[model samples]
Target: MIKTIKHFTISSLLYGLLFTSCDLDRLPMEGPSTGNFPANEQEAILGLNGAYQSISTLDAASTPIWHVMDNITDVGYARPGNNYTSPITSSVTTDNALATKPWQYHYRTIARVHLVLDNLSNLETSMDEGSYLQLAAELRFVRAYCYSQLIELYGNVPLLRHAVGLDNADVPRTPKAEIQQFILDEMSEIAEHLPINQSAYGHVRASRIAAYMLKARVALYAKRYAVAAEAAKKGLEYAEGIHDLTSFNATIDVAGKDHRAGEPDVSNIFGHEGYANSAEWIWVAEYSIAAGNTHNRQYYGASRLGKGVCYWGPTQNFIDSFQALDGLPIDESPLYDAQRPFENRDPRLDLYCVRPASRFMGYQFQPQTEHRTVFNYWPVNNGSSSEPSSVTNTDATNAYRSFSGYLWRKHLDLNDFNSTSVSGESELNVGIFRLAELFLIYAEAKIEANELDGSVYSAINKIRQRAHMPPLTEGLTQQQLRSALRYERKIELANDGLRWYDLRRWGIATDVMNGYLYLNRAGNGWSTNTLQYIDENHNPVYNHNEATKHFTTQTVIYKENKDEYWPIPASEMDANKQLIQNPGY
Candidate 1:
């Protein structure tokens, strides 16, 4: 004889309520309404789908944003050779148009999960136990992933667990350390519930192994060396017997497409065609051109080589780090010639970048060829507010102008070489997490925890051995081992957007960034005339030289500070009044 409330929508009511309320009705009850779900079961499933959908959005793993984040560290640079200008710096810090996308997207996702968890208690059927567990686990994983991204981009974000309607939007910031711990705890729990084989759910969904991999990555960023090592080992174990390394040539092919079928190959590691489900990938952000959803290849790859978007160059320091084919450092290589810098470096350098004098797409690159500099444009003016004119023709005179002195090749589809069409329809799944990264993570953790013996060498040697390079010599000290680990990471993960974060976590960004900024200018012989040239109209034209004078030797230096963390977006600050800002914003 419970009192019935007609005003409550059937969708909002629990399964028990629906059964009891409609028991007297002779006719069959309609399924849950469009606005509501049967109870905890349906809603919970919806919640999990919502979380996965959030990941599918471009912003989560957008290549353009990833490029921006990666280039700021030691390995990459923005246009006008030796210039310090790029759109990323302008937008990422201050209130700019592009910054809003990442800030908004991440919070929107977190909010969806919060709503799901808040209403979990309303689920009615005991029969829904399996569904509930799976939903809860997936939601927790998504929440942890989002929070980690937020913390990395903007430190000290408000950790919201409950759904807050518009009226109560203002929540205070949580301590970074607390947030980190919470994420670790949530991921650890979710890992236990997730399935080892996600074949039923497909590669797009997070599985038990993905959770473990994420846990290791989070632990590493938190600087918990022992925990990081343990978690990384678990992730490695889960991935073991799952994927075998593809041959060098095959890996190169997978770099071109984003479909997976048949046995795993090297290209499979990269989400290329016939390789999306390869064992190498621990987590991936899926994209479909048919869905009208794609990454911003036009921004990263369009330059003079293709459509003339912007080409961010690589630093000399990065180039120098590549070992010669014989496993010798470039500086130490007998084949090394300072004048002919591009010759005899690691094969990866050639594979990853389109440098001067390199052959690409059946053409030997000349400093003055259409094909040579086609993909080398930078978004910002190297010196001033004036924008550079786009190169309409691929003639020799415009060839070097199109070159940023470097080209990005990783995660790009070379087959899609038409410069006139500037959309990223080419199918190449952007991998968010992969096994190669985990291997380096294990190596780093072992070294940090003083476990760098044969096991550590073995882990490091695997990556080196794959690159067809020699293994590390035995009996090295901790410092030497550390150097070797760092070098391995740089070569393997370069242009994959991990270097900047690696430098920050390793506490070397300030020194390395400052040193490179100095050397690029010095080596380029920056002067009034250095960056200037005559215009096509035969008029004397000035480049970024005037603005270059503003940056003294001192302007290039940065102190590694707590402020290394980016500021929380202003919109978030306003929405969550309770949220605290990081210090020195």
Candidate 2:
């Protein structure tokens, strides 16, 4: 087992409590202060672990914040509530927990990092030079990561380089560009302090390659395409033999007797097993029941029939985004049949989501009422003498099940199925950075820069080959290549917490989100002409008149300037007078 520095020890908890009394700017008046703590190498490591504990706090809800983030975007939907529905519909308030938590938690992490950095130099004489520098670099990476998330979500935020007392706590919001530059510069400076590969350390800690990938991502988000491509190239060079894509785990047939070669199963990559033995993962946030750091991932992602409430799921728009087997979109492909939609689509559609009539966990997952009972496939696999029997399909009958009529199977694990219950928590590690995402980043940055070449095609084809899809055709224009790149990112990275950022960065959220979000709880087929076309951004466009006749519709609105970024929390504004809220709040 890998010994990750993610344990929520007593000292880490106490350090977290020190910043709980106020917002990011204030320090604790009655707890362990930085002055008397982290006085040695052991305490320094403990303090660093405290900084890492903020990652667990991100799972403030039923699932990690990253998994829940896509629910508010165009691709996924959450259980209906103000917190989930209001953001996508442009009615969210400054006091909403979803909007406030990101601001609060990210700043709290930044403060904790500053606390450790402020006193880390005291033990330099006792520790080796390389160890001391590596410790500082790791802490800086954590701070830079927090700022990266903040600038993406909230735009401009207060940038504090060091720990501050109450007198100097209030600071004005810095321009997002400056902070982006600071992140780029800091990542460049600290990349050498970290190791190139941390496989011996369980791939949980930040490595030199991970820092370059972060730099590339930040630069791409800022539209610095050349810089992004260069950083990505460096990262890929370092990761040549160290990291690559992991093949999907084989899926068992319904009889539990045969394994299918065509079916794609990602349980080994995104599930608990991936944390232990996945080469594709570059940096991870590890969770362990043994260390008392975990979240209810399977509890939120599994279906009601599988002992989960099904709090989040994919939207109909997302389901239609997958291409036909021929690598052409459903609307343009001759292989597509509206009546047999699930048969000839990309394998990832089934790999990532559980639609009606699909086998999930141990039962046939039919979310429509027509299927009263589904065949149970677990008994035979578990060595029971009794044959498989029909069981109540609670997923179809439960009032609070998935609103979109689909459930996520991406990060869920079959090994945890028997253990899943209302009270069960999952220790599956969440990926922070992975090799597949890095490849997509390189391809996208190169495409945007109009630097298309064999390398770009190789980067994209590697991902497609892994998914059993055809590679991009030769002699395509830059516009067509952009669409292809967008398609890859939308499908390959769906529900991985990056769609909302992609929509805004691509300037298509307003166009795609203002319309109605479609659903098909009955799993009914549509007319051949129901889908108008696939848009340039790879979003499926539907004919409204024909769509509502067969599918359920939900209204969504996105304001041009306002919904692009969330409002600064009301508490932060009241606590710091210098903080100016984002525009149109």
Candidate 3:
């Protein structure tokens, strides 16, 4: 018996309340004593709620930390700041907020998990066996999740099984493999006890499928291909009708009459309505303005014209990674036109990203300085009778406009446009897992294990079809299928916080990250001849000799051993004398 709890009704929206505070200065365990506080079922639920809240802390920008993570990777760029720059430049110090917050917050969650886990036996008499098992399983799932993120970001971390007092706070770092095995075993042990769908609990909590999916994802990250394949296959089989990709074909306000790109709006899936309606989300970190548990994603992610400062956007390298309309790289496909680049490109380019000459947030989103004013179609009285009128093109003329000349449109909801401000109070929920990602995980795991089959192609094609891209041809070589899978993950999972991990796990982080990150600050188009070739990973390689003269570029630095894992924070190393630092830190 791990721990026991008393009976109480768990709220459907458990994490909407203020976060439980614990003393975490010297170690994760120095907090309110977990022994007697959670004497009943409601306290246990509150303790568990704290654990979930710990993982979803927002940054100084009030953006979800997960959404802000990818901005420092090769796929995206962010406004100039030490928090964003240090990681990309590989100059991160142990005290850097970005590096330290995860270390601190995850351990804080582990602390909260231990609060209930250490004393569940107390309620074993009052709670039924099934209820007890489910409660313990959910607690363990959160602990496993915290460790999964820890091992990926920090390599080896302290594996605290229970809360410790200040006197016994010091603990040595565990081996990465040992912690990974713990996560796999914990997830496997708890999966049978969890429900397949947590819809009754607002879908924010872990379910049976979410457990297996987490297991699969951890196994895949650890390169245990067989284990990953088995777990992912089990999860997919369990998810048959309960979960599937949300369609974008619905009539959404993403496009206007003048827009040339086909309307493939994803706002219905990534916006407020998605959390309320879409079944694609497996696990979500829920937030609400009315509930006072919200973030400023709309304010940070929206463009200047949309009332945001444009803190982050995709890099030109990422923009060029989108395949042409014919399902081929732009360098190889004749359908690509340099002059009219937006046309005949992947609809995702227009759907997921806001580039020049496109309509976004009821405004023409041209970033070139020549356009001091652009057309706004937003109705005067917020009615349907409004006419298009010229408005100041802050996206083009503002000094603090988008640096990469593009804005992420994937999670930005037009419905939130009117409320976009510096308050950081947007109610959009960020997705942690989805059916499409599970399909990609299963496909990649099978391909890596040399287990070629129809299932692999079907998994990959399902995601492509949703994006309106052509289905993959039958009988592609293992290497070719690998490329196809990589393409989908890069494009489909762009700003969802997986690219940094994907680059490192695939052993291509060094090659892709240790070069110039090209930018088109003016939203200017370049010649097709500037494209040198597409790499094995489907990343576009450009002729820097000519590109340097036309586009502004940022230098990226990534050392081999040193950059693989973020350094154990200097504060942690000092706080725990038994802990040793990672390489080159």
Task: Please give each candidate's TM-score.
Answer: 0.76, 0.94, 0.94
Q: Which segments of candidate 3 are over 4 A away from where they belong?
A: 1-21, 24-29, 58-60, 250-264, 384-386
TM-score of 3: 0.94
- Residues 102-152 of candidate 1 have per-residue lDDT tens digits of 556666667656656656656635536665666678778887888888777
Q: Per-residue lDDT tens digits of candidate 3, residues 492-512?
A: 888988999999999998999
Q: What is the C-alpha RMSD of each candidate to the true structure, in Å?
A: 12.5, 3.0, 4.3
Across residues 214-298, which tens digit of lDDT does each residue of candidate 2 receive?
A: 9999999999999999999999999999998987656522211111212235767887667677899998876766556678888
How does residue 84 of candidate 2 score in lDDT? 87
408 Cα displacement, candidate 3 (Å): 0.3
Clashes of each: 32, 0, 5
- As for lDDT, the candidate ahead, 1 or 2, is 2
Model 2 alpha-carbon drift over 4 Å, by segment: 1-33, 252-264
Candidate 3 has its poorest 10 consecutive residues by lDDT at: 1-10
* Model 1 vs. true fold: TM: 0.76
lDDT ranking, best first:
2, 3, 1
Off by over 4 Å in 1: 1-47, 56-64, 79-92, 97-100, 121-128, 199-202, 250-268, 274-277, 361-363, 369-403, 418-420, 423-427, 515-559
lDDT of 2 at 165: 64
